[model samples]
Target: MNLKFIKRNIFPLVKIISTVLITSAIGLESWNIYAFLTNRNVPSSLNPIFWIERFAMTSHFIESIIAAFYAHSGKKMPIQYATYTFFVGTIGLLELFDQEND
Candidate 1:
């Protein structure tokens, strides 16, 4: 296969993957926060789950901001962004369903 073709395809794929991952992180974090708030006893900050939830929320927020900037500029974003968005979005959706099932 030609290197050029691979490069072209890879960039788009990357963007999608990133998106999905970021989105998933956000959803998972949100669920964690909700569960904590609803519970009589909140989880400690020192807990690993707390850290994971925080990171996931932060990642999602940052990715969303970047995506907004790219979209508002009316210019095509790099394939990396697209790939990221796709992954994040997918993860977010999955998280939502997972929470619902629980």
Candidate 2:
């Protein structure tokens, strides 16, 4: 119930949850792409999921590029930062910011 404890714990927990959700989504989208490639029958209702995944991937890729640029300018390892950004989204950016600040 302490505010400090909640502040310290809740944000990391949220980040972990978001990372898991994103990873699961990526897995599902990968499966969908595989199905499409293999000519498997996909239900009409699920067709939009592919497009949604595409958009999500595009956005994440762009974010990763931005993170790479930021990392380079910060004299950090760009690929490492970018890979984190690619998989975990803006929480990685937040971590980069915190490290740079330190």
Best by lDDT: 2
TM-score of each: 0.41, 0.73
lDDT of 2 by residue, 34-71 (tens): 88899997677876876786777788789889899999
User: What are the runs in model 1 whose C-alpha is more than 4 Å off?
Assistant: 1-6, 40-102
Which window of 10 residues has the lowest lDDT sum in candidate 2?
3-12
Scored by CA lDDT, what does every candidate get?
A: 0.54, 0.78
lDDT of 1 by residue, 16-56 (tens): 76656556666766766787788845556536865775676
Error of 2 at 29 (Å): 2.3
